[model samples]
Target chain A: MKLAITTSGETVDAALDSRFGRAPKFLIYDVESGAFTLLDNAQNLQAAQGAGVQAAEHVARAGVDAVITGHCGPKAFRVLSAVGIKVYTTDLPTVAAALAAFKAGSLSQAEGADVEGHW
Target chain B: MIIAIASGKGGTGKTTVAVNLALAWGAPVWLLDCDVEEPNAHLFLRADSAQQEIITVPVPQVDMARCDACGECSRFCVYHAIVAPGTKPLVFRELCHSCGGCARVCPRGAITEVARRIGVIETSEVEGVTLVGGHLDVGVAMSPPLIRAVKARIPHDGVALLDAPPGTSCPVITAIRGADAVVLVTEPTPFGLHDLTLAVQMVGALGLPMGVVVNRVGIGDNRVHAFCAAHHIPVLQEIPDDRRIAEAYSQGIPIVEALPEYRALFRQLAESVTALCAARRFVTQGDGHEHRGGGETELRPLNPATGASTTEGANANVRV
Candidate 1:
């Protein structure tokens, strides 16, 4: 399955960004191919409002089966769920660690938004 | 003449001044309570036979049949009110600024504007004034559309008094825009002075002719008066820090009605505002050009049917 992890930088070794909506960048990893690509979320970071919805939509178009981050807000949660994508909350230090945690099934899927809007 | 009573800080008595001044006018006037978030002017006006009308903003509705999910609307929308993630676009109505840009940009004609209720406007008649109160629905994120709707109720050439919401935000700008003059109410406290300075800068930046009504005097220093004097902004009236006024206010009693002794203050305030407005009109007419203001944020014009732009306020402090 393809997974998207919010990240502070472009490299998988970079720290995992806790924020989902305004993350600086996103690392999309394909477990089967062991290959990953970066989706810059700088635009979403500057969004005056609805950062969550727009960011979620950005990743949804990329066909991310799951999203890993520190917390998810209501609008982002709704958009991700409507696309049948499960949200995984993690405080893992790096993108690689979060991806590994997801592979190990150590991360729990969020039932709803872990945080309120604007979080 | 339209006069907007506003204050940057809350509870400085914008409602008190508005209600009393309208009552003291001694003539039929339109009193529009633009403080939709917490409309309190009606409590003092004691208006009767309130007729409420739900105010709705026109938001774009997409037709999937024609929507190729090109995401044109998504690309055009600055608020991210709508987005298409391959299959179809999802709309977050609360985020929509109702700019009508989406429908205007739809190349396939798949998008059409639809009414989405934001708040309600209650119109009622009091002894000396027609009270128009706007109440924003709970969880409603936008108020300018509803505030505009409330302002639209003002008849042509009618004497209207608007009780603007506290603060120097878009709502306050929306409430006071196009008015001949504004009455900025403040107290003698430091907080009041600080916010009053900001309000003055904001109104002055808008090139709005305004006067100050110092409420709850005798508490703070004379800095407020000095500041007003330094800026040449008139101190229209001052209400002393009287506990009885507070008692009457808490009881929903207008000072003019409950304490007839203070009626003269409001009367003089009304006259001052009238004279200020007349002076401004004279200046504008003499100049042969409407003073468009000192690079103020281009407010969402009085286009009720076409919900105007909220993005302009990013430059609100542009001139200030």
Candidate 2:
């Protein structure tokens, strides 16, 4: 299974970016292959609007099974759910910890958005 | 002639000044409350025969059969309002600026323009003015389109007084664009001075003639007037910080109607503004830079909007 984690840095130990849409970079990790790839989100970071929707499109195009981030807004959550991708929110501060929790089946899938849009 | 009443800071008496000035003119004029976010001038004008018109902007709708999922429409939208993922495009109507470029750039004739309601425009005729206000629907992030609809109601030959929204942002520019002259309302405090300077830069950048009306004169220093003096902008009228005026304003009554004495003050203000507009236009025809504000000409001693004379240069060297 492959999942995307919104991160501040390139490494898995980087602190998890609380923002899903405007996150600086989204680090994708594959559980079966133990591979890590970086998705640059600089284009949507300072977008005038629709940052959340565009970010969701990026992850959707990357063919990820799920998205793990600190928070998801209404637009992103809607797009993610529409594409049959589960959204898991974590406040674990580090991507390594979040990834471990996900593999251990401890992180629950979010039913809906945790924060308001433009937060 | 179109006169836009604007202020950079909120609650600096922009609505109060616009309403009273329209009434004090004592003639038929188009009073447009262009602040679509929270239109409150209607509470005071209380015009008769309210008529409402719905405002709409064009947004793109994609036909999947013809779209081919090429992502052309998504790439064409500068606002990122349209995006295609997994062979289907999603339209976020809130992010659309109604530019209509997506439909035009569609390759297979798949995209079509559809009307999207942004706001509603209401018009009513009062004794002194015809009040036109734009009410934006909730969750409508775009305001300039609605503001444009409100201004479109102004007659070509008729006079108009626009109550502009606060801050020097896109909404304010959309409200005040094409006005003959702008009246920037401000107070004497430091915050007022700072925002007034920003408002002046914004108006000045548009190459429009503008004047300052210092509201709540006694509350702070005199740096606003000094800034005006340095820029050659005429100090048009001063509204004192009076408890009676505040009380009347709080009760939804216009100052010109409740006080009755301030009527003369706004009338004089109207005359001064007319002179400024006329003189600036006359000079703009020849040399635009030489006669910006028509500074200090025929002000006729405004009876202070109230009985109190605003303290002049209260902090002449305060370095505001």
Candidate 3:
């Protein structure tokens, strides 16, 4: 029953995170303990050589069951999906709003697959 | 002395440094732009074209008349550019790294390697400097081969200044190998700092001795300086944040020519690079880890026993 939540660090509140790996910054919150951790993105590590895979591995190792972010690129989505991680989308700027939606059971796991596009 | 100017992010003025340094030297300094994908050095240093060569990569094209749909060629491709028997073996030309394993394993000898034009290397003289650059064809995937073409054009006897591609990818590796010294151009911003860290790692991984040049020095946080200090990388020169410089760039002129005062700064940059090259040679000749992985990161077939091709993934479209 460990839900790994991804949050954009706009405020000290919960916001829906739709992006899988390339989100500007990622906050991993433990649902049961309410303990939160921020991950400075290493997505640009080696500049697309191992950027996506490295970030995905770090997220996976943190035991995040679900990821919330702005968007998920195809490579990260494939890696996370293969490991049974549910992703949720949110437009909220901060982490507090995302947690509120999760607590209210209003935040739904994203139904579609992560699509790849350059921004 | 050979100097390489590289940046982790594009548009960070690698070509600008190389071109200006060549001008500062006044001698026939060899300027080679290894960016390959979008070489802008020519746009700045107007060169009279002395030579132009077409760069090509080996791609396996199936001869339908000779082969049955055995799927062996498809199986042999590590990139999975070739699909299995049901459909025409789809080749995502961009994704293909051009290792030629598919052609090697084809039982019918049906796979013939056709040279696909990837880019071109043009060599010329500009302001008494030998200028060379590889211009990648639009929509072409590979760059290392074109970079190789540019490297081959490097004159052996003089000071060769190489303008490397942005980012620490395969092409960057190809450009930086055997470089006597590297100048990492960076800005003083958060994004610049982040990418600079990766570039530092990449140059360190290659065991290439490198220095830093802070472009637009006073604009962002001093994180770039702090990073260089922590890493012990020498700071070469800081190009001032000026609008005239931008105007000069847009007008396609080297700042050394557009603004003569900057010529002295580039001259010093060239001098510093020579010093760095000497220092690296001294240190490396004493140390055992002197340039091990300086060649291409080529991926040939893993093992003949593993049936020529391995499963890339279930999602075939992920490749082609």
Show model 1 residue runs off by greater than 4 Å.
A9-15, A30-43, A61-63, A82-84, A91-96, B296-320
TM-score of chain B of each: 0.91, 0.88, 0.84
Model 2, residue A17: distance off in Å is: 1.3
Looking at model 1, the pairs that clash are none
* lDDT per residue (tens digit) for residues B9-107 in model 2: 999999999999999997888899999999999999886579999999998888888878787888887676888766567788888888888888788
Error of 3 at A16 (Å): 22
Q: Residue B134 CA error for candidate 1 (Å)?
A: 0.4
Q: What's each prediction's TM-score?
A: 0.89, 0.90, 0.65
TM-score, cand. 3: 0.65
Report the C-alpha lDDT of model 3 over B1-320, residue by residue, as the tens digit.
77889989877778888888888986778889888888888898775555888888877788778877676766676444554423334444455678888778878887778888888788888778878879999866668888888898777678899999898877888898778778999999998988888777666555567888999987989989987876677888899998999999999988988999888898898778888888767755776634433222222222111111122322211111
Cα DockQ of the candidate 1 complex = 0.66
Residues B107-186, candidate 1, lDDT per residue (tens digit)? 89999999999989998888868999999999987788889999998889879999999999888999998788889999
Assess candidate 3 and give its lDDT: 0.70
